[model samples]
Target chain A: MSDTPMEAAPFAEKAPDAPVRVLSEGLASWLLVSPLAILLAIFLVIPISVIVTVSFWGYNEWDFYPDFTFENYEYLLTSAVTFDTYVKTFSYVLMAWAFTAAIGFAVAYFLAFHVRSTVWQVALFLVCTVPFWTSNIIRMISWIPFLGRNGLANEVLLQAGLIETPLEFLLFSDFAVVLAFVHLYTLFMVVPIFNSMMRIDRSLIEAARDNGASPFQILTNVILPLSKPGLMIGSIFVVTLVMGDFITVRFMSGSQSASVGRIIQNEIALLQYPAAAASAVVLLITVLIMIAVMLRLVDIRKEL
Target chain B: MDRTETKGVSRRALLKGTAAVGAAAVGSGVIGAPMIWAQNIKDVTLRQFGTGVSNLNEVAEKVKEDLGFTLQMTALDSDSVTQRAATQPKSFDIADIEYWICKKVWGAGNLQAMDVSRIENYDKIVGIFKSGKLTPESTIAQGTAPHSVGFVPEPGARAFADEQTNWMTLIPTIYNADTLGIRPDLIGRPINNWSELLNPEFKGKASILDISAIGIMDMAMVCESMGEIQYGDKGNMTQEEIDKTIAIFIEAKRAGQFRAFWKSFDESVNLMASGEVVIQSMWSPAITAVKSKGIPCVYQPLEEGYRSWGGGLGLSANLSGLELDAAYEYINWYLSGWVGGFLMRQGYYSAVPETSKLFMSENEWGYWFEGKEATEVITNPQGSPMAQVGEVRDGGSFEERMGRVACWNAVMDENKYMVRKWNEFIAA
Candidate 1:
């Protein structure tokens, strides 16, 4: 340890301060983030490690034992059901993502620009969240009465002479599953996109207006590119959620559809923990790959 | 609603009794050994968990009244119950579960063999639980029948024995002859056979359970009734049998044969009540729930006979000494009439039907058991009238229904394959 700061300066290389001071600064940063690092290690890493270990273990009808075998993964990778389920799951993710992005962007754009006052924007944003305050299950189940064969939508359509017979496809179909995903998760997209929109410099828009650019040109050229971070974040949220969801598909599609998450859940229900663990590992990788790709597309670090 | 009232009253009574016990323990502390004598009953709290159908809050309250011990009850779905009972042995003291589950759970060694000599109504259990027969003339059903897994050779036995023994795997409690429930007001016809579940007439308005074990059984019922496949044993399907069953259902599913598949009691009720589905697999309580809403539903007796199931209570292997003693006492109280009669009102049979009869009235016994037309309005345990005058129990008397049981719900040896196939059907 050099006692004199001036004497250490010649050998410091790129260091602007004393070596001890630099070490203390790094130590302080580590101290600041250690709690989160420790938490992730304990809650996230340990459980995932156990799951990975269990995935390779053998299982009988009753219990899982510590015998390493790749049978769980082998079956999951080889089976036609697994392939079909992944295809269906990807379709749900695509549909849910597309709809949520479009609707959420429109809503967020309106709130940020057209609302005119921050107070009213906040109040209206709160109004959008009132439906979320009840429950996801209740919201999903409530749709049953509204979209059933003789439900309100059909009855209204009948009275309006919109169609001859009730629409059977409204309630328990792929249409319903996607509808529910949008209903539950559009707010996830809205809040983030709205945040990014609010943070945008107003002078840029004013300058764009001063120019002879069309409103469509201003939206596409100025706003959309700046909102890429928010879009990426919202896409991550929607994609990961849809990928990991089983309940929404189970309830909304009336058990006619299958997803990777549902496969894990079914295995867990049957007490085939090793098989579930295997399926869950596959699902985790799929979701992570999706999130990684989304992250690569846009650096969302600036948005936060 | 009235059941909740009784539960509240009993809870207050229990609090008062606990206070008395505490005061007495303090008073006797001058010459005490931690009041072990007084500590035996009230201090003992047994955690019980099982399927929602049998692990009722009412039963827990009644145990507090009769046994002077706290019975903490948690009710989960059958799959969850099996998962917890097998994996988390220390989490519960007793498991109130189905007999079919016993076959799987027993192998896990989480539950201990119960001493049958301690059961007050051991001899009074129906023959279906003993020799797998309702009568000498009755044939044993082709599933994991109660008798096959009800007993063990010794207290530490790993295997199930068909013979009557001093050690039992579970103390039988509730059972019923299950059949498809139909909307009499909607279907507009007498639905009499199991094959109608696949009939093209109700193509997109039919459903079955999403639970794989029971769903496969129902599929067998449909497949057998349609002469699609002749299974040697529908309960335990071979790989070829499993493949054929899955293929048939997968085709039906692709052709829009199902409106929806249900797992929970409420889902079945909602599917039927909303007319999203007109014919589906349903439970007794679901039919009652529908009828209570002024919807017409019937537990129709098909020409092919009924699919049946039984539920019982078993002690966790971790239970011993005073807690185990209290569990036995609680089980004895359960068999001694009150719970039997309570469950019977909901269209289930008590293990000791004779004792249950003591708790029920002549009219109730006649209506629910004898299948006679109810002379007066018959109410459920909650005291709301469910049946009007001259209405008979669906599927008729105990003998007529239970005697005709085609098979019991079971887990096949090819359960993993069956589950995969079931998932495939859902995907299709």
Candidate 2:
């Protein structure tokens, strides 16, 4: 009752003016937020909702119809290929994550800690980002000459007498897929990790050192905990990107390997939208589960 | 409020407003046909969605100058064209697509049955193309029946379409026989059969196309040669047949018989040019691409025969009135001798050879159509010298090449299963 009277004092003093002022403030905020909200709803939410809705639909060669059927899901569930593809996709995701996290963390750590000058730090960061200025397809194809049987790597190795013949598996193999993924996605890991490491209080490290903690000990105890959010975010990016990537796998692996995304792409190519949607929904759920696990590990929301 | 109203308009704001208004006017001018019609109706632009096989910007400009209507063509790959046809039917007035896509588009109700009377050059379509099947099986009792798979023929047209057919699905445009492109320097032997794709000697040095519909047919030819399976109609495979064919590919893939599975025309070219792959299923244009690089790439004519695919123009169901009329003019112009000659120069054969002949010089006709040795340098689609003097077109004359079409690239009834299996093979 007392709070109510206190809240109403302004209303009582300036009756209509106060309510109108409050209403206009709320309206202005709404106007400010609307553009982003509308864009999100239109582009992101609507497409996802459509995919979810279509996942339950039935389709033939000619048309996709609005009939609730679990047949698409059932077929996916029963298929051995789906299981194999998911396993392969997950393996790629795991392998890409390990390499990206290690490389990204190392690069980020060096820039954040060692590079004292802000200008040098920025220049170094840009150097890391320079590859991104070009189209990714061109960058991916550039690896062909570097890694091909008669490529620079093989030529160098042959000159060194490391092996008699050129390596066949270097170009169109699982190794190439991981190499391309690391090349493309390590930057995704680096930027966030760098940002997180930048935010780490230097005093915390100094204090840990004062407490007789080694540099390794400081990293494990203080820096690691502080950088959890960035790690989680980077992991999410790498995992999701690797899982959803069809092009890199298609090109780098020379279409010798299949990911879940590739199968969905194949279905879309065949105009099997419902099947593609179902596969997409399953992929989305799988990604969500992975994100949930990462979220559990760090609680990125709380950290941010 | 009175002071605000009295204030002079800022030059920046005035200029911005003027620019916005001008842009809106221009945008509306492009979209609104009636606005153009009110001033001048003769210059209607018809929207065309052409497949990558016939990406002729020069021809489109020529058509605009010749015909009153401007031809705005958007080139798309086959899959994108099919997807667009299915989902966005009203996007194009006409789509130039493959014969396989005709049935799918027709079934989806995206394409309209073309009125033969609208096409001025309809009769000029060749007799063999009108028959639909370039190579109908010899035995009617057991082998697949010879049938025209292009636009459903108008009634009284020969064995190509159903005898009583009245609907025309696609107006035949361009076609060619595709074969395996190999590096002669690496292989150092005469390759004559499709079974060479699986030959252990070339293991880890051969690639196949990544397309399921077309790639599966290529593999089916290999299976036939190896005596693994004999398809009644290789174009259309049953579930068991698809499984059998895919199994052969999977087995070969497991044994490292393939260096890669190529997707685009350029990828095939790159694979051959870079010496990453020794032999692979390649398009005719890809062969030209490799050969242009001064590579000793040969588009080998296998004993099993060439895998052929044909494309033609079809009117969109949503098109009508002036747009439809413009579309007809564009189609007629495409069949006109100049465009055919343009396509012929590019390595694609037009439906009407006579029209192409009229546009071509005697040397072009001799080299391209009659399969005689070139007396002079023969140019590719891009007008680059593809063949020097005395160089003969591979597989001899056009008749010799197209006549032995082993199979047409088909979207089989088991397409879904085949796609799934193909993905499995890729993943495996």
Candidate 3:
């Protein structure tokens, strides 16, 4: 194969030394990137391509076929249930993101500004991350005993005469699902925000104080603006995680709820691979658009 | 938290180390075919793949000692087992799966038919399974179409070509009925029918399983009991039946009649023990678990009869020659004596009950099989004290329970329709 492009020939002929150096640099860059490129192709690109190809295939009750058909996509697009399920899934994502961001921001702020000692800050930040030590499934299940009808929350309330009747909507409702999601995913929000908050110039806060700005005003004008990149990154994480979740919703809502991911899971369970693949593709596109919007709102590159 | 991060880092490092070693091995041709081929062919490690039901490590150890071949058992969930069997048959040598998976897997040509002549204990399986019909009355009465005969003979088998097929689809293993579990203290009355799961009095206290296939079947039974609809066959519902059943489910769910829909056995137990649900669909083990916590719960015997299921061992289509012979030996060993007795102690019935008797003592047989009051304290499969001297099995005897099986678990023709509707119901 020809090593040089046709348009570059004039430059290469004028400076043969430059062409040799350029070729060597190009080879080094290719060698450096080949391992990561190969990994990405194998793990991400190949699997996504397979899913997309499978989404176009046909399937009957017994098995999937290689025939190209739009029936899977048609069914998904036309169904009323599909729209409703997506709306419900997005509601979960929105709620989870809001709660996680609020909780994560508060915790990160406390560690960065309120805690004076470095050792104390590190130790306390680790404490906020204590739940991450357990598996997601275990963490979700632990809530059952704490929030069930005869669980600690209910019994304590009843004993103290806080209410006339025991609350029946604690364990297996929308409340429990949202609770579990917040508990499991807030860590994603905390780490990025904490990293951003730690990098903020302490002198900026001192300057704001000298200018007679209130704590809330300083937070609103300076700290919030500086932390937008971290907040955007955290939001992307929470949104994608909540949107793609199936197990937490399945277990916590006691199967009373369905996310888009859960719908895909249902199709796979029924041996309907084409339909599942189509649903998965739809979710992937939706998540990508959301992330694109979030990235557009904040230029993380400048901040980093 | 720091410990977890360090542990994660170490795990990643271990994975990278493994990848490096693998790359080196490939570069040096150390894992080449000649090296693999040089080993004794009969010394092959038979890969036993199935759900946790069949992945008893103790049994695998016993098989290895007796047969002088490694039996490597890989446990997966139901969906994953079917997925692997359907897409990658050669990854496993023998498959121990439920009977319902046979039709789908066999139709895909992923499973091979067992030669009845080779299985030494083949003749000893209970007559009910071999015949597929326990009695004339036991046949499904709702369906006009000829019901699917349970023991399916494979293509090109001698029995299928020459005479009535003795070539079985699955060598029968353990089986049991699943029904409603109820908290006795809360109900304040005897609940005897499947309709009680939907009783208005129990609204906000009842739950069902989350699995679409099994959950729909349980709901179908509830519908049939309530005179809401009639089914041609509950196991294989038509599209219209599935739609109607799920619509009813949606209406009920919207009305706030259910507390939750459980996905796992432990979740079901937790629901019962914590008194979140007073009534729900449950497995036998879950019922045992609730009671073990000193909570008053029962695996209620419903008047509509029980939804039953069975599983067994099948050879993969890829295995042949020495590996095939070894698979046959393992299947025979599963039904021989010890494994059956082991499973029977866990409240499941073995195909050859008589063979299981060879391994059990008189007191154990009297308690587990005969359903007599325990003359002495009886231990469960885990050797925990499950019952005192006067306790009895919930449905009476093994024969009484198995004989009352109304329908076997099936992969319905309308599974796609059911799944779609089930999702709608959950969303609604």
The lDDT for every candidate, in the order shown, is: 0.89, 0.80, 0.79
Off by over 4 Å in 3: A1-39, A115-123, A198-213, B1-44, B65-68, B135-164
Task: Compose the digit string of candidate 2's lDDT tens values, residues B251-327.
Answer: 88899898998888888888899899999999988888888888998989988888887788878888778777667
The complex in candidate 3 yields a DockQ of 0.43
The stretch of ten residues in a row with the least summed lDDT in candidate 3 chain A is: A17-26
TM-score of chain B of each: 0.92, 0.85, 0.84
Task: Give residue B175's error in model 3 in angstroms.
Answer: 2.1
Candidate that would win on DockQ: 1
The parts of candidate 2 lying over 4 Å away from their true place are A1-40, B1-41, B118-120, B133-147, B151-161, B164-166
**Residue-level error in angstroms, candidate 3, position B162:** 14
Model 2 chain B lowest lDDT segment of ten: B138-147
Candidate 3 structure quality by residue, lDDT tens digits, A79-165: 988899898888888888889999999988998899999999999988987887888899998897888787889999999999777
RMSD (Cα, Å) for all candidates, in order, is: 6.9, 8.1, 10.2
Best model per lDDT? 1
Candidate 1: tens digits of C-alpha lDDT, residues A25-141: 567679879999999999999999999999999988778899889999999999999999999999999999999999999999999999998799999999989998899999988
Q: What is the lDDT of candidate 2?
A: 0.80
Considering TM-score, which of the candidate structures 1 and 2 is the better prediction for this target?
Answer: 1
Q: Tell me how much of the true interface, by contacts, candidate 1 captures.
A: 0.82
Provide per-model DockQ scores.
0.70, 0.53, 0.43
